[model samples]
Target: MNAVTRLLRDLVAIPSVNPRLLGPDVETPAEEPVAEYLSVLAKKHGLDVSRQAVLPGRRNLLVRLKPSGKVKKRILLAPHMDVVPADDSQFKPSISNGRLYGRGACDTKGCIAAYFHALCQIAKYKQRLQHTEIIFLGLIDEEHLQSGSRAYARNGPKADLAIVGEPTRLQIITAHKGDFWWQLKVVGKAAHGATPHLGKSAVHQMARTVEILLTEYNDSLKEKQHPLLGSPTINIGVIQGGTQPNIVPDTCSIDIDRRTLPGETENTVRKEILDVLKPHGLKPDFLDLRGVPCDALETNPALPLVQRFMKVARRRRTLGADFFTDASPLASAGIPAILYGPGDIAQAHTSEEWIDLTQLEQATEVVKRFLQEVES
Candidate 1:
């Protein structure tokens, strides 16, 4: 097997499922194993490695390769190490018809394999490069709240440009929609189900709120559309209230997902939500909680690094993704970042996830070429 294939197989075989998807019975629930594995691989390749602990027993691993001459630019290869939960059988990677099947085989492990191989080759040919710094960051909790990337962006050691590892079918992504979430809660008096008139129902009030969001808010969002990203959108993901059918619930809470466009911030979204609530008499108390807030990415196509990557990869089209990525946080921190990798985003988080070996090879070649091009 090739080095990239072997690396991907090893990564797939190890169960580094995100803790949020599992119960408390798991002994090791974070990306510690995968982080350590990549760390050892970097050391084996004679590179400098370090870790920034994001959570207890979980860390974001960074491996670096320094050039011989003065560094002109720094490029980061960021791929999340954590995968969504999977069954025990899924942990054992199996190859069939030139495809590797496993939980994270396509989502990002394929990028890890491709990036690592290219990094190894670049380090081997370090003397050929004039000036450039290459870094591979194996981030944790990307499938969750992206806390790893958040911490990395907030803390020290920033980069000039970055290639965030996500399944883009080997395409160069210049823009993608933003992801933000809020929790709406309605509190009311509780009473017996038989005497419904004695107390108000929070669920009823919440239903009206949901209708307003589903209709007015979404309609208003459609008017403000992004060029690459179609329109700002919202989805009611989860709703929980009431203990049983026989009792009036005192509280109803729902999670709302808002996909924002460029020029939108947490405060802006908050105000928009409040405006939607005001007409219906719903107060700010309804939207009292917020989830991991991230911005949409809109990199200038004329930027040197972006143009170099597109020219090196030989891809013509510039597109946007409906999903979110770690690039948003990095870009918010003043670093030019784009999403590019092997495989398709469709296979991510699927039950029988797999990545095409052909695409993987193509992506590997692209990474090598981009690194050399940017460095030169």
Candidate 2:
């Protein structure tokens, strides 16, 4: 098998499922095995390697390759090592009809393999090029709280530009929507269902709140449009209320997902939504409890490094993704960041997840060429 194929297979074989957050049925954290495996790979490749362990065994592994002399520009390549929970039936890595099937294959592990293989080739052909440094960051908890990326951003080597690894189908993604993830709780009086007049149903209140939000806030969001990203969108991902059919619900909770644009922040979106419900006499508690907050990655497409990458890869056009990535923190730190890698986002997080080998090969070639262009 090719080096890229072998690397992908090995990565897929290692289960790195993130543990449930303080649940009664919690599983052991899955980020460690991937970290341990990458550590050995870094040593094998003779690259300078280090780790920033967040939990006991889980760590964000960083591997760096440097030129012999003084450097100019630093390019950061980041790929998450963790995967969302896989179906018990599809956890094993299998190949059929030129596609590699497994969890995280297209979501990120494919990008991991592509980046590593390209770096291996670069190490083999070490020469005096323009690039000062190339750093590969295999991060943890991206599928969970984004703790690894957040930690890396707090204490990371400064770089001129960052290329976050995700399934972008070999396209150079210049922008994507940010996120305002929040939990909302609505309260009401509980009583027997038979006495409808005595009890105010929290579920009814929740329905009204949702209607007001969808009618007022949702339409307003559509007015602000991004060139490539289009307009912001909102989805009520989860909602729960009454305990039993006979009981009037005392409280109901909902999870709202708000996609943000370039000029938007979480505070602005949160306030606007709450304001819409004011007329209805609704007062719901909004909490930003999710440890991982999604901030948008806004990068200038005209950066020298980005231009070189586009030219080397012969990219015809640029686009934006609706998915959130590690690029946010990097961009927040004033470094130019882009989400670009192989595989399609559509195939991500699916039971039959797979990536085309041909696409993987093409992506590897692009990475090699892009590195050569930057370094040479």
Candidate 3:
């Protein structure tokens, strides 16, 4: 097996499931094992390594390749370390049909392996990198709260450009949608089952609120569309109301997952919802489920570095991703970021997650070449 494929297999074999995905009493190392493994590997290669404490036991690992000469430009290679909850069998990685199968195989671990392989290859000619410094950041808690990236953004150095890695089929992604979660609750007086007219039904009012959001509010969102990301989207994932069939529901609530495009803010979105609901005399309580909104990423494709990277990847046009990534937080911190990596996102978070070996090798080579070019 090639070096990149071997590294990916080893990584998959180590279970680094996000702690939030597990039960409270469940004993798991979370991302510690993977962070230690990468730390040892970095030290073996004589690279600078450090850790950024994110949570009580979780930390983000940093492996750096400093230039021999003065540092003029800084490039960050960021790939998340945490994976979604998986069965024990999924942790034992296996290779078959030119694919590596395991948890986080395509979701992100492939990106971590490919980026590390490329960094190691570039370390051979350190003298050539006179002015550019490359850093490999293994972020934690990306599957849950994204605390790792948030901590790095607040404490990490300012980077000229950041290459956020994910399963993108090796495409250069310049834009992606953001996620905003909210819960709307409608309140009403409880009434007896027999006398339904005595007290108002909150569930019935919530039904109207949901209808407006699904129809009129949804249609309005379609009118404002982003070229690459398309239109914003809203999904009523959950609804809770009433205790029993007879008792009138005093309170009804719905959890909403709104995918926001560029230029869309929490205030604007809330205002839009209010505008639609107020006309119908419906004023539900609004609560921000996600304390901090995940903003959309829209890096200028015209930047010199971006253009050069696209040229290296041999892509004439940039693409957009519907899902959010660590790129947004870094970008919001003033660093231009983009997503690129091997494998398909369809295989992410699946029962049988796997990555294509051919794409993995290609991604390593592409990243290596890009780093060399940036150095020169």
Candidate 4:
């Protein structure tokens, strides 16, 4: 097996599932093993590596390559290391029909392996005056609130250009949707179900509220459209109320997922939702919002580096991605970033996640070629 294939197999064998997505007791040394493995390889190749403590135990691994001459261009390569929880049996790697299958096979161990392979080659044997300094970061907590990226952006070194790895099938993605999470709780009086008129029903109130949001709010969102990303979306993901059927529900709660466009902010979108609900006299009682919102990505496609990378990859068409990635935090920090990597986004997080070998090879070549063209 080649280097990329071998690296991906090893990555799949290690379980680095995100702890935030599972029960409290269910925790693995998320990304520690992967970072160690990469560190060993970096040392073996005579490259410098550093680790930053992101959470208590979780860490972000970084590799910086200094230019032979004065640095003229700065580039960042960031790929997340966490994956959603999966069965232990799914961690076993399998190859069938040129596709490697396992947990995180597509949702980014493939990209991580590919990036490592290309970086190793670039570090040891690039035969030209290097005017570019490249920094590769393997981040933590991308499957949840993207705390890793946020932390890195706040404290890490800045770059002129960055590529946040994702399963984009080697496409150059310049724009994508953002994510906003809100937890809403409604309170009412409780009494006997038989004589429901004695007490107000929180379940009833929630039903009416959800109905209006589904019809009116969803319809109104269509008018606010983006050329490549299309329209923002709302998903009422979770709803819970009442303990028993005999008693009227005293409280009802729901978790709202709002997919924002490039132009929207947390405050502006929340205000719009409030405007819709104000007429109905329904306001949030205990709404818990995410501390940081993942803003939509919209890097100027006209950037010279972007245009040059596209030419190097021989890709003429640029499109928007539907999924949020680490690019959000990096972009929000003023780094001109885009998402690009192997494997289809559809295969990510699936039960039988896999990546085609051909695509992996192509993606590795693309990374190498793009790095080689970083001239002063």
Candidate 5:
């Protein structure tokens, strides 16, 4: 097997699932194993490896390939180590029909493996490195709020480019969407269900609010379309209200997920929703997301490095996806970041998530070529 494939298999063997954040007991967040494992690999490959404890017991690993005492460009290679929870039956990695089936196979383990393979290939020619420095950062908590990326970006070494690993089928992604989460609460007086006229129903009020917000959301989609990223979207992912079916409930709540574009802000989006509900006498609280928001990533397509990479791929057309990634945090820090890697995003977070072996190999080759071009 190729180095990338072998690395992917190794990554799959390690189950680094994110702990439940809202369980009965506070699940201690931990991701040390993955960090330690990556560190070991980096050391074996003769690269300087380091770890940062971004959270208690959770660490981010950084591996660097310094230039051969020259002034080459710098590139940041980043992949999230923590994977979302996997079903009990899907904990182990299995290969079938040239596809690797596992929890993080499509979401990011594939990218991790591909990146390592690329790095391994580059190591063979370390003496030829011109003026480039490649830094590989394996982060934590991307499945939740992107804590690792935020922390790393806050105190990270400056780099010219950041290639965030995701399941992009090896496409160079310059744009995607951002995320905004809000929890809304509606209050009303409770009364018996039979006393229909005697009580105010919070559920009924929330229904009106939801209706108006959906209308506004749909209207905004028609306003303008981003050249790469099409449009912003809104999804009411959760709704809860009432106790007994007959009682006029006094409280109702909804969790909204708003997908934004490059120029959109949380305040502006929240204001649009609030405006829709204000006139209806439906007041609700907007909650802040506990983690980092995945902002849209837009890199200069005309950059020398980007253009060179594209030439290596020999592809004229690129795509923009709707998924959010760690690229946002890195981009916000003034790093030209892009989302690129192997596997289909459609399979991510699915019960039967898998990554094509061919895609993984292709991605590894792409990473190696891009690094060599910039490094040399």
Candidate 6:
């Protein structure tokens, strides 16, 4: 097996499941194990390694490859360390049909292995990078609140460019949709079940509200389109109402997942929804479910470095993603960030998550070539 593949297997073996996805009584390992392993590996290679404290027990690991001369530009290669919770057996990586199977095999551990392997290869060759400095950043909590990336953006040095890793099938993604979550609650008076007219039904009102939003409101969003990201989208992911079949439901609530495009804000989205329900006299209370804002990413494809990287990857056109990533947070902090990596996003977080070995090797070579050429 190639060095990068071996590294991916090692990373997958270590349980780095995010704590937020676990039950209160469940005892599972977090990102610390992966961070420590990366730290040790970086040190062994004679690289400058450091850790930034994110949460109490978790940290973001950074390994640096400084230039031979004065540094004029900084390039960040970042991949998240945390993974969604999975069965214990999924942590044990397996190989089948030229693919590696395990949790986080495609979601991001593959990117980590590819990027770090490229950095190590460059270091081993003693490439004379006179004006460019490369950093490999292993971020934590990307699957949850994205606190690690947010903290780094607030305190970390601003780089000229950041390549945030995700499974994009090696496509150079310059734009992606953002994620916003909120709950809409409708209240009514409760009374005897037999006398239905005596009590107002919150569930009945909420049903009408959901219908309009899904039909009329969703259709309206199609008009507000972005060239690269297409258009904003919405989904009623969850709903809760009533206690028993006979009892009148006093309160009904629904959790909404709004995929916002560039230039869309929380205020505007809320206002639009309210406007739709206003004519019908449906004034449901809105509750913000997401504590932090996850804005959309739209990196300028015209940037010289981005253009060069695209050329290195042999891509003639830019692409966009519907899912959100850590790139948006870093970009919001004034860094130009884009997503690029091996594997397909379809395989991420699946029961049989796996990445093609061929794509893994190709991604490693592409990153290495980009680093080698960026020195000029």
Clash pairs, candidate 1, are none
lDDT by residue (1-376, candidate 4, tens digit) is: 8889999999999999998888778767888998898899888776779988889899899987778888787888888999888888879999999999999988898888888888888877854437778878999999987888888888888888888889898899999999888887788899998988898888888887888788999999999989889999999999999988989999998899999999898789888887888799887554657777688999998899999889887889688989999998999898899888999989888888999889898989888878876683
In candidate 4, residue 148 scores what lDDT? 84
lDDT of 3 at 242: 92
Q: After best superposition, candidate 2 residue 265: deviation in angstroms?
A: 1.1
- Residues 207-268, model 5: lDDT tens digits: 98888778865686658588888888778889999999899999999898888888888777
Candidate 1 lDDT tens digits, 1-376: 7878889999998888889667667657578888888888888878899989888788898898887788777889998898998888888999999999998998899999999889888777654455678889889989877888888889937788889999999888889888677787889889999998998889988888889889988899889977888989999999888898989988998888888887888788878988988988886354534346678998887888888888888977678898889988888888888999999999898888999988888889998888877755
TM-score of each: 0.92, 0.90, 0.98, 0.94, 0.91, 0.95
Q: Alpha carbon lDDT of residue 276, candidate 5?
A: 66
- Give candidate 5's TM-score: 0.91
Better by lDDT, candidate 5 or 1: 1
**lDDT at residue 197 of model 3 (Cα atoms):** 87
Give lDDT tens digits, candidate 2, residues 213-320.
888878887898889889999888999899998889999989988888888877787788778888889989988857566787678888888888888778866788
lDDT of each: 0.85, 0.82, 0.92, 0.87, 0.81, 0.92
Specify the highest-TM-score model's number: 3
How do the residues 15-41 of candidate 6 rate in per-residue lDDT, one tens digit apiece?
A: 899988886665655888998898888
- Superposed model 5: Cα runs more than 4 Å off: 21-30, 70-72, 87-91, 191-199, 244-247, 289-291
RMSD to true structure for each model, in Å: 2.3, 2.5, 1.2, 1.9, 2.5, 1.6
lDDT of 3 by residue, 1-376 (tens): 9899999999999999998888777767889999899889888888899999989888999999998889899999999999999899999999999999999999899999999989987775553588888999999989888898899999998898999989999999999999889999999989898888888899999999999999999998899888899999999999999998888889999999999998888888888899999999999988989797699999999999998899899999999999989999999999999999999999999999999999999999989989989744
Model 2 residue 257 lDDT score = 86
Clashing pairs in 5: 72-131, 72-132
Which 10 consecutive residues of model 4 have the lowest summed lDDT? Answer: 123-132
lDDT of 2 at 101: 92
Which ten-residue region of model 6 has the weakest summed lDDT? 20-29
| Model 6 TM | 0.95
lDDT of 3: 0.92
